[model samples]
Target: MLRNVATVIWDGVAPFEFGVVCEAFGLDRSDDGVPLLEFGICAPQPGLVRTSLGFGIEVVDGLGRLEEADLVCVPAMRRGDPLPDGVTEALWRAHDRGARLLTVCSGAFALGEAGLLDGRECTTHWKYTDQLSARFPEAKVVPEVLYVDSGQIITSAGTAAGLDACLHIWRQEYGAAVASAVARRMVVPPQRDGGQAQFISRPVPEIDAETLGPLLAWISAHLHEELDVDSLARQVLMSPRTFARRFRAETGATPYAWITAQRVRRAEEMLERTERPVEWIAGEVGFGNAAALRHHFTRVRGLSPQAYRRRFACGESAESA
Candidate 1:
């Protein structure tokens, strides 16, 4: 149903993230049976735009091209640049015409500035969560998720999370089959729930190289087991306090939080790939029971596992037939 898409670009754009949007939507993957997305890249001025990394990108279209698009995408911006004056007006016009608006990373700042996110649930990169909340108190900013889709407006976290949001749009517009095929061609996961926490720095003590790698691997493999800091510390021949310190330094997260995230990731994979009962899957993923899994899954993914499974896996049976 997405017949045409326009990506808005500006000076000091993050090239790789900008390219991710183009790669996902601009290319024709019809040979692989994927629906073609009519894509156009536009800038405020129809000329060369300087990237944050000191490179020039030649964009041929200007903001006028966005007038007829079914969707408008805004890529991440450099840290502190002011948005163009007319750009927000152009976006407001597009929204008034009923076009969907999307943003990747700091691109949400533009949406916030345009007054589109007021009284809506939205998200941006965790690094800017506080700033976004402070700047737009009327907008509900969810910092932990990979992305947020509030009907007509969609926003995502940093870099790779942009890919997830794009694929989500594909799934919503077409279906999971098409989104999965596109994801396969790109060699990325088709869906990652947006609510996963951004990995942040912790304050663990340093461990010697000889024992660290094996210990970490062992913990990952035994996630289904009862893993307390004390037991893990014993395996690495360190006190609980010392192990906690080292984990923070090495992984940029506490051991407990990291373990929970890994378990949730596994649960998501099962929800997409298998038709097991939620209660059983919860126990298998080390949540101990279904209620605990539902709590954490909702907290981390912004949806119950059942709701996510229904969205992505519902049509599988029909397709298989």
Candidate 2:
């Protein structure tokens, strides 16, 4: 249960993300008779902090305030800049004293820089996924999900996703009912399971009106079929090389990658809607075997097929038995 929370601020901090954290924890919510959170903004200098959006905020506390906090939050920062030396040291001290560390959006960069996320599952805004993964390979970077809660450390995706993460923390500490009440007071959805996808770039395929649309429709309807690029090319009356080039140009992904993504999408739908055996679901998704299905599903979804099914399958038996 978190009663005391502190947010660390620096120059160039995003105003909107910072405000989200403040609204979640800093506001006096005792009017509704809910347990009020002790929240305040802390800076290294204890003065006006300039925001990314050309405004200055007067903060009263400094990094020393974090020592008494049960939870510490760092909001988004400008991409590709070194965090201030004092802020880094303060974060390290707070973590050493057993504060639950949290980062929203590019704040993960700060955590990653401090090496707090090493070997932990985490995520940030999808736009920074590649750079974050490259910078912190030791940290398992899960790009698609809204947030990752790895016990003492948590990281969330872009802007609005931070709201979901904060609500989740409230739920875990005070139970869903209290969290729901807080959400109603705040006028937002009470619970958005952290496993929900973040903003993903979707590039639709382009084919000549004569051939492409129908071919994609066929592939989607018959995912159980073996969809080799050579065979698909033959269906569209083009050579494999030409077909592969066209597919990549249109969809911004290779044929194999696109097919694997679609198969995983189908598997996700089935796992949510049915209680099929993992092996059977793998076969139906054209993965040939459960192992291959698990491989690709984990690659895209960050969870094994069995785990995904368990999370979503609603307790029904396979084939409605």
Relative to the true structure, how large is the alpha-carbon lDDT of every model? Answer: 0.82, 0.80
Any idea how many clashes model 2 has? 0
- Candidate 1 regions with alpha-carbon error over 4 angstroms: 1-5, 23-38, 52-55, 64-71, 78-82, 93-109, 116-207, 210-213, 318-321
lDDT by residue (tens digit), candidate 2, 109-179? 99998888899999999889889999988989998678899988989988878988998787556544556
Q: Which pairs clash in the backbone of model 1?
A: 145-194, 145-195, 146-194, 204-245, 204-246, 205-245, 205-246
Q: Give the alpha carbon lDDT tens digit for every residue of 1-321 in model 1.
A: 688999999998888879878988999899987878789999999899998898999999989989979999999886466778689899999999999988999999888888899999999988899999999899999876788989899999888889989988886766556777899999997766555445534333335344366877777677678888999899888899988877766655678887897787677667766788888888888898889999998886667888878765644752110
lDDT of 2: 0.80
Task: Name the top lDDT candidate.
Answer: 1
Candidate 2: residue 143 Cα off by (Å):
0.7
Model 2 residue 126 CA deviation (Å) reads 0.7
List TM-score per model, in order: 0.68, 0.63
lDDT of 1: 0.82
Q: In TM-score terms, which candidate is top?
A: 1
Number of colliding residue pairs in each model: 7, 0
What are the per-model C-alpha RMSD values against the true structure?
5.1, 8.4
